[model samples]
Target: MATISTLSDLYISELKDLWSANDQMARALKKITPQATNAKLSQLLEEAQTGIADHTQLLKALIANQGEEVSKEHCKGMEGLVSEALKHVLEQPPQNGPVLDALIIAQYQRMTHYGITGFGTVAAFANALQMEDDGRQLKDAVDDLYDADELMSELAEAAVNREAAEE
Candidate 1:
């Protein structure tokens, strides 16, 4: 008789899916950089691309560490975010320079919040699973995710808010 083990398998799958989604986001953001009218927005998009790449690499490494084959399930959460961002970009044209920058900043914050929450959830799940090494790695990654969100928030407060308020 053969016994099947399910522990950590679902999480492993989810990690890969998230990795793929982030990789895709990086690629998309690379394309989106040219569309950014504001310099800060453009730089943030570039930073996001780099962050996404790092996340993808870390996720792949984590999956490998677990002795599981890397495979990505479809990530509907990211897809929905992408769709909403695109819709906003298309539908509501900014009235002025400051308004445009604020809109961009708002989109960036929304995306960052999503990533932070998602990563935090995964890290907690890893801890509960008793995968100490995986949990630690994921915890570190989640920290990075939070840092990224804070950076965007800082950029928004320093520049975007000022610009938006001026006009």
Candidate 2:
């Protein structure tokens, strides 16, 4: 961790945190994807893994562009969310089918919301620093996260929840 003497430092710190969070999510999604019985949900999870990887790379580039060492501060917020998600999975003895799919969707949205906020915040910071290009890139990432979250909600309301009720 470096000393935060300016907004740029704070911005870099937030980026590092988000980078770590995405990395953690990528790993967690791999574990959870196999537990999902819904084909759409499994596919989305796989896609999210790729998105997270791309976002992580963006963060690394942003940090390196600032002439700072590319590193990650442990993201405790994501750690807790991941643990809670795993707990939900473990609590359900038969981790398959619609019920599990519903839980996975819920957890997935929760984490996506976190990413949206983190990316949006960093984008704001970029704008404050007069870095328009960086702000635009970060905002694009945030928009992508929002799209994924909205899709999950649609899946839950239109399909997964209904299937869970039938189960």
lDDT of 2 by residue, 11-128 (tens): 9999999998998888888888888888889988888888899899999999999898899999999999988988787555354478889999999988999999999999999999
* Reference-based lDDT, residue 7, model 2: 100
Where does candidate 2 stray beyond 4 Å? 91-96
Report the C-alpha displacement of residue 31, candidate 2, in angstroms: 0.3
Question: How many times do residue backbones clash in model 1?
Answer: 0
Candidate 1, residues 97-149: lDDT per residue as tens digits?
Answer: 66766666676667667777766777777888887787787778778877777
Q: Pairing residues by index, what is the TM-score of model 1?
A: 0.83
Candidate 2: 10-residue stretch with minimal lDDT: 87-96
CA-only RMSD, every prediction:
3.5, 1.2
**TM-scores for every candidate against the unseen true structure:** 0.83, 0.96
